[model samples]
Target: MTAMHRMTLAELVGGLSAGDFSSSELTRHFLDRIAAHDAQLNSFITVTEEAAMAAARKADEARAAGNAGPLAGIPLAQKDIFNTKGVRTSCGSRMLDNYIAPYDARVIEGFNDAGAVMLGKTNMDEFAMGSSNETSWYGAVKNPWDTERVPGGSSGGSAAAVAARLAPAATGTDTGGSIRQPAALCGITGLKPTYGRVSRWGMIAFASSLDQAGPMAPSAEDCALLLQAMAGFDERDSTCMNEPVDDYSAGLTQPIDGLKIGLPKEYFTEGLDSAVEARVREALKHYESLGAELVEITLPNSHLSAPAYYVVAPAECSSNLSRFDGVRFGHRCDNPKDLEDMYCRSRGEGFGDEVKRRILVGAYALSAGYYDAYYLKAQQIRRLISNDFAEAFKQVDVIMGPTTPTPAFRLGEKADDPISMYLSDIYTIAVNLAGLPGMSVPVGTVDDLPVGLHIVGNYWSEARLLNIAHRLQMDTDWHKQIPEAFA
Candidate 1:
């Protein structure tokens, strides 16, 4: 009971069902942790203490009546990117800082329906724009492993919260490797379901086509349970897939024997840290021991993924972010000279530096004359990257690689160098462009910093991906290792 904060979401569910702890007690324990430890991590933007306690009470009552749902009473955090009814849904920017969402995002609705307690909204990069959480207007999230280092961006707060044991698990959106990158740096598990596998209705858009919400937790098994509740079709969101979602948790114990693990030659190139590469290679060896075969595969166009992503993501973001112009529900500048001035001032005042940079780049890519040269060319490259994956999948079940070139780097180390920051997501962006499911599992550490083994699967292969990761987790303690300070 004293170490309740250390339990995974799956363990918490078991404890709740076994009557070892009431949902209210569990919720209170997490709320207390957030209150105590989150100040240092700066992971949470808001803590819905009253709503969480109320929900916990209701869950306890339902359990007593023998009508509890699978995730009933589990305390979790939501990334600020998701709209929460009656709560501030800031996208970690000044623009939405004062905006309270009128309704819950579909994922929020799903969790609420399952009677899960909403702990709070975790911080994120402003408009999900940066590779490091430093882009967040609320402030950067410090990696729990080492406060001087960053918890990877965009979904950084969610990863940091779960990694630091401030919350059992949290929701995160992956756009250009946000979820997986952060999870890897924080030594946790993150799953980015295939594009359209999860609804995007109430998720604040970054790059519409690439933004997919998923679960970030301490273990793949914990992610499976949360994904079970988070993923599915939603007519309201045209991007949501209508296909039936497999019971993700049902196959956790399924054997991954004879699984073909593909190693992309492009992912292990010059820039990769030697220590990080060694750990990833060791992870592949472990999978080989589990009866999984390793195949050397080539994603020839993988090298072009970063360049293509830079263009395509910005173009889409420019269009999507245009709605935030002062006329609507976000921030508005006071005493405007005219409509043009208002538009200029509001946007200029609202967006952070990173968001502004992306917006300008996006606007340029979509410009009339440059559209074909830049945006169209990038789209073609995206298709090539997707085709490479298609060919690789023909020979292998899943592609494996290093999630990042290195582990959690010191905060501000690359803040001024945008190129270095963008390169951090190089290994992960292609999966998003190709609309594939990808995950990051803590495999080992390099120089005492966590390294993630990247796993990518074909479309709708989330179940297989989870099974593979869970098998590895069962044989290793990396995912279970918490920062000594947090522990």
Candidate 2:
């Protein structure tokens, strides 16, 4: 029999159903791996051993009684941004380091109801503000492929945990490229559903209109299973769509004979690395052999995505983070001269440098005199970017491109250069601005490090995207590759 730690989520489910192993045993196997290996990765913030054991035991009992849920007995990691009842929901900042959520977020509730065991909360960039996990208050998460290299952010901890086999699968949120970027850097599959596709009731907001929760795992098939439990309508969050959720796993085996793939000329421009582009182009050629047609498309406004995102995201972040003032439940200053002093000192002492930079930028952009010039102008540009995708979709079923300009870089490589770090998400930010679904699939490696092929689909087309990614995985072994140290 294959080792429990090496099995994918689906394989684990089959093992549990066949009575080859108890949920308690599988849970312990993962817990032991985390203890043995996490010292080198710094991926997890908390490990809920006692609670996880109790859940596993309950799942075993339910399975014996023939009342198991679809995902019963699976152990998964939750990103710390999601609120879990009685658990610390720090959005990776000292401000809320002591804040324990009184209720579960909608995503957490969905996973719990599906009978998944929460292994613990993974670390993340402080307030989900940076492109590399270096901005995390706890510390930067190390990439499993090479301990000296960084795992991408702000979902770097979740990505690192899954790649290292510390967890079978994990939950992640994407405000810009948080989920997909890290998954690409770590050589795993990640899916960022359309905006409002997954409820954000208790998710710590970075950009209210753009933030979304998704799944990260070993393959598109595993992501399909995880997404099935996550997608649904929730009245608690006003932004959540009332549209019906589709069975994400049901269409994984669907054929893509006449699929049209868009190759954006803009995504293949000068800044892209030669090696990375080669892998992406090769993957597109494989799709061509599968009878999928490739068409040339243009997103002319794509060059303006970074500037527009910088303005809009920070503006929304400033408004959302205002609730963390000292008078509230977060960190408060010890010595206070006055009410104003307390507010200033609390925020000054609590927030990290990257978070402070974004807050300042946001406040400036939304200030009285600059609001029309900066904020409004950024919004107009955002609309143009969205329209670019709308027009391209009329000519293609999905867009193909390189996920990042290069593979994982050494730790602290771009930490001093904020612009360079921000540009790390250049290819991914436009999708969020347009409210479309996007995913990253492992295509191949460059210099022993993994590269990802980016796929963008129209809104509510997650099922079709999964089918395409799954078909590619069937023809290649890239997604199954594991880091040597971890393996």
Candidate 1 local Cα displacement, residue 179, angstroms: 0.5
Worst 10 residues of 1 by lDDT: 1-10
Which sections of candidate 2 miss by over 4 Å?
none
Cα lDDT listed for each candidate: 0.94, 0.93
lDDT by residue (tens digit), candidate 2, 1-487: 9888788888999999999999999999999989999999999988899999999999999999999988898999999999999988888999989899999999999898899999999999998888778988889999999999999999999999999989999999998899999999999999999998999999999999899999999999999999998998899889899878888888888889899999999999999999999999999999999999999999999999999999999999999999899886879989989999999999998899999999999999999999999999999999999999999999999999999999999999999999999999999999999999999999999998999999999999999999999999989988888898888
lDDT of 1 by residue, 237-343 (tens): 99898988999999998988899999998888899999999999999999989899999999999889999999999899999999999897989999999999999
- lDDT of prediction 1: 0.94
TM-score of each: 0.99, 0.99
TM-score of 2: 0.99
